[model samples]
Target: MIEKHTSNNGLRIVLENIPAVRSVTIGIWILTGSRNETNLNNGISHFLEHMFFKGTNTRSPQDIAEEFDSIGGQVNAFTSKEYTCLFAKVLDTHKEYALEILADMFFHSSFDELEMEREKKVIYEEIKMYEDTPDDIVHDLLAQASYGGHPLGYPILGTEEHLKGFNADTLRNYMKEQYIPENVVISVAGNTDDSFIGKIENYFGSYNAEYKPSNIVRPTFLANTIERNKDTEQAHLCLGYDGLPVGHENTYSLIIMNNVLGGSMSSRLFQEVREKQGLAYSVFSYHSSFLDNGLLTIYAGTGKDQLPLLRDTIDKTVETLIKSGLTDKELTNSKEQLKGNLMLSLESTNSRMSRNGRNEMLLNRHRTLDEMISEIDAVSHDSIQKVIEKLFNQSSSTALIAPDTSG
Candidate 1:
């Protein structure tokens, strides 16, 4: 069972106890990310996440690292399009210690001038590394093609120019605007009990910030095609189709549908693109659901000479799926696979904490295992057909990174 509580100041806490495990994972989730940023601060949310570990008012960066190492705990943080999470996993005996350090990082980060300059150089290298990976950066190009000039199209790692301008004031001001109590959730999973809630509340609760009503503008999906010429051996292609938002009633249907399309080795994209045609080594599709909209992305990488065949094959596959829909066998297998994946994920404390944290942060609700399985089983052919039609009714946005034609 997942226990939930709302603190007096609106910080939400979710705890799931797994008596079989000897460890606990705690995550601090904030409902702010690149989507909430402007062009000027396109990467501040991610930059701020990096700064949290530089040092806290009470602990040096090395001290923090050594403390966690001494306890054999793992700590990390990441920034995504719609949210940021700072999380830790440690033995149950060290749960309180982990929480305290996380809280200190949250509330007392020094954002030292020297550290800021040093981290800026680190992020500059990080940006360069991302630029060097064509296959990886192609997805960011897809976002640009799909959302056009919207903030949703912005990359999580802001530009080097933008990163240079971020100082202590910039971080604090951004936090004041985006990191309010109502937008925060503290998630815990493993051998801990509800008593741990009080300790979390003691640290995170009672903090007050000016609560400004949310003014997030929903992004409009565009079917624009964006192509980049790079000196590369393979052409990277991505297709983005408009899909449903988070917690839509047909979410299970879409998941099963995607699984049949390209989510697994037995999937059509994998079977047809790689096994039979030998067009590419990597081919897959995934769905990303945001607060108000979603995107279903299909990706394939192939030698420059085979790019045309790869595109034609993908188009034919999508067309066939649209015309004939899913086979009953495919539907049944996908549903079972989804359920199995869910069950296997519950075996890990980190997965449980992440699931609970995201559920509470985005949906503000949790469902039982039975309820989830029931929903997955309830996905029917008609429902999946509806989702398929809904997702592919319009032309898709396209992004491609191919060898330079100038040569």
Candidate 2:
């Protein structure tokens, strides 16, 4: 079970105690990411995440590293389109120590000028590395095709020009604007009791930032096509369709439908595009849900010369699924697989912390295990058909990266 508390300043804390495990995982979830940025500050959220580890007021980067290593704990952070998380997993005996170091990194990072410049050079190479991976970058291109000039279309890694402009002031100002109490959640899981919530509050509570009304604009779905001819040996293609937002009524149905389409090894896309025709080595699909919107993405890579055949096969597979709908076997198997995945994830404290943190951050509510299992089991063919129709009813945005053989 999970216990919830709200700080006086509106920061929320969620704790789950699993007495059987001697490990604990703590996560600090911030509801600000690339979608919260502007064109000029496209990747500041991700950059700021990197900066938190560079140094704090009292701990050098090396000191922070050695502290975790000394205690056999792990710490990491990630930036996404809509949120950022800095998390640590440590033995139960070291939870309080881990929390102190994390709080230090969060509140007192110096953002030194030298450290910022060094990280900028590292990010420059990171950008170049991303550019060189055609298959990886094809998805970013799909975002550009789908949302055009919206912040949602911007890459999480801002351009070098923008990176060069970031300084201590730039980061501090952005944090002041977006990292308000109402936009943060502290989640902890495993072997910890309710008393830990008070400990969390001591470190995170009472801090105040000027509340600003949200000016987030809901983005429109566009079906633009983007093609970048590169020097890669294989062609990478992605197709995007309009999807339901987080917590939409038909989300479970959509999940089952997507699993049947391209989400797994036995999925139609995998069977038709790869197993039967030997078209590509990797082909899959997934759904990404945002605050007010969602996107379903299908991706595949094939030999440059077989691009036409690969695309045709993928199109035919999708067409067949939409027209005929899912089989009884597909529906039953997908539901069971999803239920198993959900249950298995609870075996680890890290997964529990992440699940609770994300649910609290996005939904502002939590459902019991039985309730979730019942919902998954309740998925029906008719419901899945509705989601299929809703997802594929519109034209799809497309992106492609292939060799520039035409020249």
Model 1 CA deviation exceeding 4 Å by range: none
> What are the TM-scores, per candidate, against the unseen true structure?
0.99, 0.99
- 1-407 in candidate 2: lDDT tens per residue? 89999999999999999999999999999999999999999999999999999999899999999999999999999999999999999999999999999999999999999999999999999999999998889999999999999988999998999999999999999999999999999999999999999899899998999999888899999999999999888999999998989889788899989999999999999999899999999999999999899999999999988989998888888888889999999999999999999999999999999999999999999999899999999999889889888888989999999988586
Per-model root-mean-square deviation over C-alphas? 0.7, 0.7
State the lDDT at 160 in candidate 2: 95
Give, for candidate 2, the lowest lDDT window spanning 10 residues.
313-322
Cα lDDT, all candidates: 0.95, 0.94
In model 1, what lDDT does residue 189 have?
Answer: 99
Error of 1 at 257 (Å): 0.8
